[model samples]
Target: MSHSRRSILGAALGLPAAVAVGTVATATPAAAAAVDATAWTNLELETGITPQPGATPQVRTVTILGTTFLQARGAITCNLAADTKIGTLPAAMTPPTWYVRATSPRNNSQGINACRFEVNTAGSVTIYGATSGNPITWVQFDSVQTIWR
Candidate 1:
């Protein structure tokens, strides 16, 4: 009679337990190689925001384990009004309306500028956390987690 490992152990320990028994089959190697799954795609920025030198503002999206994540890094400059639309992400990668905080260099002059950003379902990106006297000099989004819906 074939017995499961759990059953054998339970019997050896003199304990009552439910055991699951199954056949052990040998595995076969795949005949073909797997394809590349690099799916990081770049997003475009709006006209108001300019990519800084060597720190160009960029946004990208990548889906892992059926969940899509939006990642924005680098530096950008926008002298527009508050809540100004900055850019649009891909429809598939865009999440529901979310307000996230980013860092700015000149806003506080000490690299602690926590600028609020709005990421909407339509893929619209906006900055609504700066005042007239504190226009965002450069915003960074490398540390924020933006999950798409």
Candidate 2:
């Protein structure tokens, strides 16, 4: 089934819209105020994962209007050539009970070496798929964003 533009935008903004009419709806003040950013907190990497060269990993919780968001940035490297756990988030910034995926910076193999990461409700952040032949040693978060609440 196809979704109307109004419905897609409504769902993304956490608002209700008249999907049948197929018209765009103006965002409420509450929704417009969702751009506020909070201070960044230093994120400690899990054992076995270390920041690459000059990169410093960090996280922050921002309240966009009524919705809570978690943001992470910087880069890291893993000591093991396998799925690696990156770090943990604070309780207040813990995401909803789901796997939130983010893409790492592209590798030398013409971007085929990029890896996927998942952040769970337990605040554990992990990167998947690293092998001996094509080891995923470096990852840049690039201000990854996910819903926290």
Candidate 3:
């Protein structure tokens, strides 16, 4: 009776093993080495902001790697009491409407804000800003990039 019980247990284990072997055999090479769609590469952006307020205005350039994504954020500010204005010229000056705004005196306000840009090509992007009469304080911008190869 004990020998018969052992045989029945062996058969039960063997049945599952056979099924697993069959499943493995049916699996394609592509399925076994399935490519992960969610995989991503490490991306970094070398960022810098210039004309540290009270200094000469200079062009700020950021370099990014090949076929990458770019994002930028910036703020230009001046003391409204001092009669200062902020303007943005993206690529060119000609416009049906040239956009310019007065810097908000509100402490938390991001005066003269600009959004991100998508760059798929390898190059340098220059952002320019200037202050007229009295020197502007803490006028700056920043950018970051991510590259997937």
Candidate 4:
């Protein structure tokens, strides 16, 4: 019968207590190897992204290897359903990856906000989270640092 280490130890030592996992100090060889193998290299470029003129201000850029990431660190505020250019991309989102995604909207009280974002061939980013109400100012837009290769 295959007995757990705990059962064997309990029977031997007569200690009727449950022991939490990771009792041993050193890591197992397989665990160590798995950790070493699954290393990530998500790089951030030193260059900064310049924001266009509007309420939708403050855009940042970070590059990793050949891939480029355009990110908005803070809440990107947009003015009244206007098409505010968020920031420029490294290259145009091609036909295959033409559509970019936006996640985690900061505010969704009144209605669902729309991420009207577009990447042009000349590497221009035009995006805004706008509401449907009159004089609708969208607040707190969250995007996951859209990447371009």
* Candidate topping lDDT: 2
For residues 55-100, could you state the per-residue lDDT of candidate 4 as single tens digits?
3333444554333444553444335444455554433222214444
Q: What digit string (tens of lDDT, one per residue) describes model 3 on residues 1-149?
A: 22233564586577877797887789887763443332222122223333334432222222232222222334333343232223322332122121112121122333544322222223223222323432334444343323222
The numbered model that scores best in TM-score is 2
Model 3 scores what on Cα lDDT?
Answer: 0.32
lDDT of 2 by residue, 1-149 (tens): 22233554566676444653343355455655657777776665787777877668878767755656667787886644678777886555545566666666635443466677677767788887776767776788874776655
Please report how far candidate 2 places residue 16 from its true position, in Å: 14
* TM-score of model 3 (CA atoms): 0.19
In candidate 4, residue 61 scores what lDDT? 47
RMSD of 3: 21.0
In model 4, the runs with Cα more than 4 Å from the true position are 1-56, 82-106, 128-136
lDDT of 1 by residue, 94-130 (tens): 4555443343333564344577666765667776666
Model 1 vs. true fold: TM? 0.56
Q: List the candidate 3 regions with Cα displacement exceeding 4 Å.
A: 1-53, 67-77, 80-85, 88-138, 142-149
What's the distance in Å from true for residue 21, model 1? Answer: 25
Which candidate order results from sorting by lDDT in descending order?
2, 1, 4, 3
TM per candidate comes to: 0.56, 0.67, 0.19, 0.38
lDDT of each: 0.56, 0.67, 0.32, 0.42
